[model samples]
Target: MAYMSGNPSNVSFVGAFLNTLGDRLFSAFNVAVEANGRMARVEALQALSDEQLAAKGLRREDIARHVFSDIFDV
Candidate 1:
């Protein structure tokens, strides 16, 4: 009795896994780009004067937290 049976199910499973992996990789890349954008925003904001930042309702100390506000609960 041959214990190994070539089946289409196995191929489908592999394909599905690869697709999921690719999606996850793309999502991660997008998140990285978004984070970088947030960092840049924070840097630009920091370069502004305190009065300017206050006008925008932002504080120097809150820059990082503000940038990641959408990503984190804080």
Candidate 2:
């Protein structure tokens, strides 16, 4: 009997692993961007005065909640 060496199972395993790894990498990338964006929003809001906040319809009390929403709404 001759030896046969091609394995479809190995190909499928490798493809699945690559796909999972790609998804994890993409998720991590998105999380990092979201965190950075939230930080920027917080900074921007903190830089504004109480009068400026009222003018823009954003209360000082809602800064944290609104900044988090602005980043994660995507």
Best by TM-score: 1
Off by over 4 Å in 1: 1-5
Worst 10 residues of 2 by lDDT: 65-74
Judge candidate 2 at residue 57 and give its lDDT: 90
The lDDT of model 1 is: 0.89
lDDT of 1 at 37: 88
Give the per-residue lDDT digits (tens) of candidate 1, residues 1-74: 65756787998999999999999999999989987988899889889999998998988898888888878888
Deviation in angstroms for 66 in model 2? 1.3
Residue 69 in candidate 2, Cα distance off native in Å: 2.7
Across 4-43, the per-residue lDDT of candidate 2 in tens digits comes to 5779899889999999999999999999998898889889
Give each model a TM-score.
0.80, 0.74
